[model samples]
Target chain A: MTRPAPLAAGISAAAAAGRRAPVLHAEALQLRFGAVAALRDVSLSVAENEIHAIIGPNGAGKSSLLNCLSGFYRPQSGRVYFDGEDITQLRPHRRAAAGLGRTFQGIQTYPSMTARENILTGFHNRMRTGVFGALVWWGRVRAEEEAFTAKAEEIIEFLELEELRHAVVGDLSYGLRKRVDLGRAMALEPRILIMDEPMAGMNPEEKGDLARFILDIRDANRIPVVLVEHDMEVVMDISDTVTVLDFGEVIAVGTPREVRENEAVIAAYLGTE
Target chain B: MLPTGVLFETYSAEAGLLKTARARVAVAALVLALLAAPLATGAYLQGVATHMFITLIAVYGLHVTVGMAGQINIAQSAFVGVGAFATARLSEFGLPFFIVVPVAALVTGAVSVVFALPAARVKGFYLALTTFAAQVLFPIIVLGLPTSWLGGLVGLAVEPLTVAGRPMNTPTHMYYFTLALTLIASYAAFNLHRSRFGRALKAVRDNDVAAEVMGIDVLRHKIMAFFVGSMFAGVAGSCMAWVLQFVTVESFTLFTSVWYLGMLIVGGAYSPIGAILGVAFITLVQEGLHELGTAILRSGAQEAGGAIFAATNIALGACILIALIFEPRGLAHRWQVLKTGLQLWPFPHR
Candidate 1:
């Protein structure tokens, strides 16, 4: 794929600054559920400020890979490195604290909470005030909460979700819920963001809007994104690199155009269809 | 447009103290009324009310376990038994009532932790069975063991409690004492629900997987809840022993645990109001049945009176079944629905 001129400039500048170490790296990750090996020998790396996409046919273990990275599943054998630290055995919230944020394919919004409150739950780890401080409504805790609230509001405005800030997540549409889920992950202010099928159930218009938002997030925060999505058009448009998986194995890895033309990628999709 | 009423509404939502201004006022008024109940009621009613107050403390403990923590316990009466026996034994040595009560509560809380061990590994019917075993074992161990402290099958007599050299042997004094303790216990339980630990417990109850994912230690919270709940039960047991001036194995039977569980279901498991309401309703019903039996016997229907007394359990069983089927959420939920309806009067949205 032909890289965008500005993105190529940014990449070369980062490379010049000695940004060779991957922000997140997974090596030979394997997971087994009973008789089925959900993932086998899966390896991937995400560079700083780049949009990396993982795409495959159905049952390619895309979700399983995301789960392992997010600390939901412990692989039988593998190591995950985040920010140059080995975080293979860290718990989910600990990983989140270490600047790793993730959103689920299925919406996991707390139904009883408003959009703003749901996002605030993501900021739980960042808030340093103890229980006593919260109970007394001390000055420092109030200031801290106010600061986080302002940040969350900025994220809401960026996502164009200000109108739905006070609305309960249960009452929102699927597309809106997806955006709210993204807002929640953003509240964590992670250095690396992992999105699992952000456009899975959105219409074409919604998909375009989310794609623009994703790009804006990358530009504004300079945070690398690891996206697992099936939308080929989106993958081609936004991704700096694309990896194709087939039955838990990485079959192809290159620029979007290169993967699109690979014989192995074509064969994997053809056999499934 | 600049924000005016919008800011006010947002402020109210963010306040997180009760839900509305009216609720604040209502809670304040209720507290005042409870403080004045002893002055208004007669002696016999005061005694009955004091008993109700004690039972409410026990019910509140069960509420923490079954309602908030989502753990079924049929062993609360066993903890009560431990507390009651502990109090009696201590009082026999001439220990003050205040000293005995707290000591009993702690001992019972510790015993509850023992019963809660199986809860870490089992749930639902299996957990209930473990508690049931504890309930049965309490009576057998107390009665079978030839211990002078427990007084064997007959039990021990308690010394009358006194405040500032004035003995509280009268029903009216005991009523105020029990009522004050009940208020403190209720306040503590309600405040806990709003605390971080309380929210963690509720999170564990609502969804253990999600709570664990959120980094809450589910096992630790569950066990802590059991300890707190049993501590409350211990207070009730100690108070009951003091009020009656006696302690016996029969008083803290397995049947008491079953009745406490029934009270939790009838009153509504999650609400503190439900705990008090359930206790009041169950106590009043039992008293009413006893009165009816007396009236029947006095009217020369001795045989029918015997049958009516025998059938009381059947009636209570039927009420529990019906309440479970029709109002599974309990009376507390019904009360909330009513309150919300009144607050948002002329608008039907909940």
Candidate 2:
């Protein structure tokens, strides 16, 4: 408990169990904003313990794909399946409750709350104590709160945010806020984490820190990751499988190296202004 | 903000309402003062203190709904009116004040849920307008009823508050009664602030999208805030009924709703102490203005009392303006700054 256990244990266990079922599968998604098509015939799958990266240009529908996957945007025609159960039409909160966790493109935390409180808020679905228990603050509420705070503390320690745990999120630096946002998502203990531009607007050092955190979230925690990213270096380095999109269409999908060397991906990147 | 240089090694210690030993001592002293107040003060002062406590209860509700939950509820006084009428009707059925008060609170809470239902779709100005409709429509509905139903604007007289066959006739007796209810209400509010539900409400308030993704049911929390807030307002309204000995449609006006909100803003909408301080400060200002107007009339200023009575409204407006401009966070933030400065005196505060 002092340090993160090797997620390889979980990965090996998953492999030994011979589970090939995709943790998440999106099929032929078609999303349109009025007359403009944002995603057309886009399909992808994230396996257990895999970090799947979706990379593309500004108008390449990377965000739209993430939105569809997380149930924030309903695809005009598509099916999203989590654990092989169709969830294409579920509401955002319902999806989250069904083990879909996400961090926004813009770092979002409870602004007036402390980092600890913000992280604790992420455990909303976990806590079962009701209004009467909360108002009374008796044995049950205190116990649940203590248990959850300990859980939240583990995440804080994992992220090395001990000093900033009590700091108000509004006053924290951007890098710290991003860490807190990730910590919030991690608090859900989701089977799959969907991050939109997790390293956006970060300096190289901050980006490195975030990239390591993302990898830790995937490898150390053994959680499947679905990321929409712009930083190609981090994407190629950490991503297990890469799906490249261009003009709302999938151009290539393979291992990171395969996608990196794909003639179509090269043309898509070079062809953009 | 705990005392400077303090360190809490446990979550309970850090999250405790009285985090520092100094705060515990201060609260103990305040409770002692509150207990002794009835004996020390005259009837007029006791009456004023009773009013302050009642207003604090209502403001605390507003603080939860508007301040923490980030739902603007202008119809809080309407909820209060609902409570008062509920109390009046229940007393007519020969129920005791203790039973009648809680019934009133529950009734008003249920009524607030009706108003809050539409909040699932509307937000900000639109939501405020929705609650405003409650404020505007409440009196009309109350007055439109037959005279036998809700007194038809003439109002209904509340039966005397009695507990265990003892009539609470004197202001001192009623003060103790109000004090007990206030203590219970404030304790619940304090506990609620550190509770999981309270944190969830804040999360929804800060960013509903993030809250939803974090698995918080935003609409449920918003409506819960309204329910709890109106429940507190209901308690306050029952207290007001006892204080006034009557319930009237005219008493729960839009002006009354505005007054409650102004008190919240002046006190700081985020804390119970802020609500209490806000109600106390505004009540004192109104009384002082009235006293000033009386003195002016006694000193041969013809009709100055009427003008001064009108000037009290102007002064209330000025108080809100000044608080908003100078300390938008309210007196609670000012109190915090002062306390922090004092705690770290002789050293540079970070």
Candidate 3:
């Protein structure tokens, strides 16, 4: 596979650390919207530095799972644990403050703000001062803002978005907007990055570029990723472990090679092979 | 990595008004012109200018609620009435005008938060109707109060505002005072546009769900916007009390709230300058129409002049509808288009 040797070594060390302490754990999660069961006892665990991809058919509840984890939706009968803390009832902002970052299925860029300003918002929770400090622009607030800017610059560089950084997010192309959205999430410096359909509407060339960027982020940051994607080839190529979901139930969970050859996954995709 | 010097230079690049040399010059010109208005204009014109500035202040309040937060509020004139009555009653206790003004604003701001309660659950047209109820109820409540504190329907007369031992009774003095306060308010509003609170308000306006997802307390920002907006309206009403030397139920009527909204629509909702421009334009137009009516009466076209005076509401209604249809964003957008067109002369791309 020609993975960087040093990166592979670092990944192993990170994996060991991750195994010692899992970052996010969900137990017996159940969510219902009126009569329909959106999620039913979907227990899942995400380790600190592992790339976990969640694959599913059209209504398999992948998004609902992500939403529950991020505090957008409160499950009726389950608890979510982050860094060994019970966070089932925490608000989204509190979750963001505690190092959980996510991007939406469609880009949610603040159209009025420039790309830099959009990314700066991701660092809102990290800012030390309240309204007074910001108004005066003094002391700790200045230091915090500078630190955030430096970190944002690093993310912009990593994403190769230097030219697009000054442009308003509303004016950017869809591919560029997606990259900016990812960059914003990275700016949060989250321990766990949850992406909803990160590769939904990209050309092949754009896909290749994004694939490289995703790999670099995972390798460099050692941050675990929970990706919900439709592209089987990209998921198969990059995901360390794959969980196949169908009809709101886990069809299989294993290494990519094992999941690919499973009769059930093939049948779910091809309709009775 | 880019060179340190180059990176620093790029990072320091200013956005908004601070970035543009032309905007700086324009601001300077505006300040100078405002400072000179009292010197150049006559007594009646100065009085009109003072009225215009006070109306501008109230419109700025509407700007915060409608323009920035995207919340519909038609009860701003009721808040203004609250401020006016509060200022009048407080001043009657022999308190200084300066103290009375701010206290009136704070009281009105608190009352505005009370009015904003329904904003948490309702929005758009329904919220507008709720505020409309406030506007309708305000005059009735003011008149129904048993105490003569609010002057009942007869209203109360306000003493002249004295500054530093000098009574500001003349039109020129009132003009200068109103102009100074208006300028300060405008500058503060402009500074707020670049503040985090301003961005939060805009975010909530654009999409409350996304704003919540981004960690913004949508309800808090919405209420804060209402408070700030109401404070400006209070200040304006207090100044109006000083200028008219009286406070009355008729002065801050439901019709006045509609006029303020029309001014904002005509001037530009998003631009602060639009608030001032809209007030000035509407005031001048109404005065000119009044003068024309007076001239026609003198020139033997008495019946036509009487008809025009009686049908002023029709004229105002038509003007508002036409402005909305033709220039939805108001005068500020038109001004922006013109400026941009000039800046990009011969290129023709916005």
Model-by-model DockQ, in order: 0.19, 0.67, 0.29
The candidate 2 chain B region of ten consecutive residues with least summed lDDT is: B1-10
DockQ of 1: 0.19
True contacts kept of each: 0.06, 0.75, 0.20
Q: Which prediction has the highest TM-score against the true structure?
A: 2
Q: B55 in model 1: Cα distance from truth in Å?
A: 2.5
Tens digits of per-residue lDDT for model 3, B124-183: 888888889888888898899965668887898887788987888899999888888788
Candidate 1 lDDT tens digits, B37-62: 87888888788888889888998999
lDDT of 2 at B187: 90
Q: Indicate the docking level reached by candidate 2.
A: medium
Stretches of model 1 off by over 4 angstroms after superposition = A1-20, A49-52, A91-102, A105-227, A233-241, A254-258, B1-21, B85-106, B140-160, B164-166, B347-350
Winner on DockQ between 1 and 2 is 2
Task: Give model 2's DockQ, 2 decimals.
Answer: 0.67
Between candidates 2 and 3, the one scoring higher on TM-score is 2
Q: What share of the true interface contacts does candidate 3 keep?
A: 0.20
> Model 1 residue B72 lDDT?
89
Error of 3 at B322 (Å): 3.7
Give the fraction of native contacts in model 1: 0.06
